[model samples]
Target: MTFAKLRVRAMMVALLLSIFAVGGRGVSAQTNAYATAFTTSITYQNIGTGTANINLTVYSSSGTPSAIPASTLAQNGAGSYFVGSVSGLGTTFNGSAVISADQPIAATLVQIPAAASQVKNRPLSNGFSSGSDVVLIPTVLKSFANYTSKFVIQNTDSVANDFTVQFINPANGAVVHTANPANVLPNTSVYYDAGTIAALTGTFNGSVKVTAVKTGTTNPGSAVGTALELQTNGVGAYASQAFPASAAATKVFMATSLCNLVIPSGATTTFYAVQNAGTASASVTVTYVGTAGSTPVNVTSTATTIAAGAKASFNPCGLAPNGFSGSATINSTQPILAIGKVSGAGLYTAFEGATAGSAKTALPYVRWLAPAQGGQQTFIAIQNVGTTAATNVTVKYYSGSGTLLGTHTIPSIAAGAKASSNPTSASPSAAGMGVGGGSAVVEGTGAQLIVVTRVTSPVTGGTTGEDYNGIPFN
Candidate 1:
């Protein structure tokens, strides 16, 4: 395996469709204040046969470009499924997008943060798979107070590139900051504003190991081709997080749908930031799954190493008890990477756990429109890393022009276990499924289960969030 280690092991086993935008809203807030505005959705699926219309192009990250739009995906007769959304595109702007279809396609490009009331709906999942070079962005920040992170790079190769954006320091990997913004012309895309970098400009919190090399080969070839991480709390509107080519993971699934009984700390407390990215030093095991009689604790701290690439953030309710809510599964002998943040009452969801539970059958087609349930109210969590129990487990619901809104069967799910509900409390809402919103697909014939999709919103001390971990479709 050489050719950039087989494209970094085929981009650590697939996922990353290329996208970046600042779109509408004066870009520049989050430290001195509030800045939010970014939404890029480009979904595709058309094996081949009947109808077809796909051609989307947008570039800027330094490759500056624009012009080419022809959406019309309406052919589910044999191979169909087309989603579109690429208007204007301005704001902080730093882009790269290309979608041309003749048939054979299965794409995804998502980025959220367009609405606001208080702003608390963070969902990010970026990638670069097809045999990699360098794309391992576990988490990068600059918290001196709340939070501030924004590092976008897009060269998804076709030619020109010259990358290198280090920024390590996960506890002691060194490299405070490094830059080279302005030589990414392939599909085009570039942006680095860790809240206005000044070689870190002060209190630097990090982890961003990009490497697009291979134009002349010094090894890390292929000149860094993908990365999109947008963190925020400085004031809201910066959603998108999921850039892991190989942070390693033996198992991880710590999700919560807020069982509120007063657990406030900053949105509700349920964080589990575990990042090892291996090289040696790992050792962990925390299991906490409650409700069905509750009793599966194990995790009083002590017995958690993590130190290779470094990163730690715990509070899984200490692994159950004190107002314990639900969901927990972290097992690592080494090969680790996790993320789970669930804010308090006003609501705010943060997700990216289950580095191996597998994102919704691995990209099991899920669409959102009709406001994805209008004000927002979507829940679905299924964990069963398998050791046994997993009776039937199937969640199928659709609506939003696709219509089908039905099917929901989750009888058992023990083994390592987990099962959050919402479809009128897990199977019952009949043909209206979750009521509004739209799109879903979670299967199980044998059972290994791993699905996640939250999405609350109402504000004023009620709800507010956005979650994800269900993208697996090759």
Candidate 2:
């Protein structure tokens, strides 16, 4: 398997189509502070088939960007907004880059801000509204040992920007380093600290892509937007938790290749096994037992086939199943959400706290959008009310009074899929409460998941937010 591992498995189907595109925005007020630096002037007119009308104007770099007149700013069908939601301008900006497939295209942009601006200044942003197949990787990574690790890349755009680092070598895709236009100044995030670049002594597994470009676009729009090579061997997880199945398959939930997750052996020692593929092709197998359920020797395998509402993963290394004695049986019919990634050999550990009322029901985490650290961070809105797809789901955060703060795990979501997360690094203290307080029941033997929680209170004027349909809240 080479060709960059078959283009990293065909780029995981465009990373599940940008997580089934609804638009992302999570993590509010974490406070890294890169304030005051406006002068955003965007203009792109293509207006026809796949469409493109975009027009933006923001000054303050010195002011006079024409005094700020893009027709007062507020057009609808192509792209024009003074503010609608770019969420705190910390950056999430996504893309699809199409401009001519038939009509109605719009990778992103929906403004309205100017009422003195304050959802952290409101500039709002979106470039591939659904067009520009944005993929630009300008690498420079360097860490095979001194290890401190952070190098993240997920600015699914809603303001705050800066992500340009390319280094491709998924084993022969080769590119090495080619992302030199760095400036994620808007939404706020860009990472560094593997000692500071330059290490990997030998065998080299290569893979590095940290893209989010739209500062002056000279064209970095397709070929899946190239750049994804930063592999040491790959596989690093711990942000998946969701287990709830027994309400007689919650209403109507399809997706059953087989499902199981018992793990009842004297309580915590080592546990993690998640496999979700809610039906389309069906392929499942996972087992581990000790408390009398029997089946031990420990195993791991991850085939694939869950198109109804896709998600897949099978992990086992801690050991305790060659014959078994207590409990852990997951036969299959579709439904497996287990979590306990906790290992940080290369690094990325944080979040292993909330179970608060844990009776046990799948809880997944790994859906992020960062850059807020003031309100104390607390947002949860994993809405996919269930008609079919709700694979590996888990979203837990609190503040309004319940106060939990941390937990996110998402793998599959399609049916009605809505997204939002704030596993708290900081910024939200709490808002209206309701979302079942902090929400995280998500069951699936057959199915169940329809979470909600929107808290944003770092004070200032204290109110929080919500958007609906297109999905947005902080």
User: What does candidate 1's lDDT look like per residue over 1-474, in tens digits?
Assistant: 211111110011011112232333333333322244444444444333434555556665555565564655433211122111334443245555555655433443444444442344534343333423465556667654466666566666666666777787767667777775534566565666576777876767667766676455454434323223333444333234435455457777665523333633233656666777777778776666665225444444556776776677677553455556667777778877777766555444566776554324433224332344555556777777767888877776645344445667878888766776555643446334333234566666666667766655554445555566664442
* Cα lDDT of model 2 by residue, 1-474, tens digit: 211100000010011111112254223332211211122212222222222222233221111221222222111121222222223222322221122222232232112112222323211122323212233221222433221222323232333343455454532344444545453333222333232345443333333444455555643322222111122233221111112221111112111111222222112122332323233334554443232244323333444343222233333333443223222223445533222222221211111111111112322111122224333223444444445776665544332222344445666765533445554422342233332222222322343333322222232433222111111111
The ten-residue window of minimal lDDT in model 2 covers 5-14
Residue 109 error, candidate 1, Å: 4.8
lDDT of each: 0.53, 0.28
The C-alpha stretches of model 2 lying farther than 4 A from their native spots are 1-164, 172-177, 183-294, 297-399, 403-436, 439-474
TM-score of each: 0.34, 0.22
Instruction: Pick out the ten consecutive residues of candidate 1 with the lowest summed lDDT.
Output: 5-14
The candidate maximizing lDDT is 1
In Å, residue 76's CA in model 1 sits off its true spot by 14
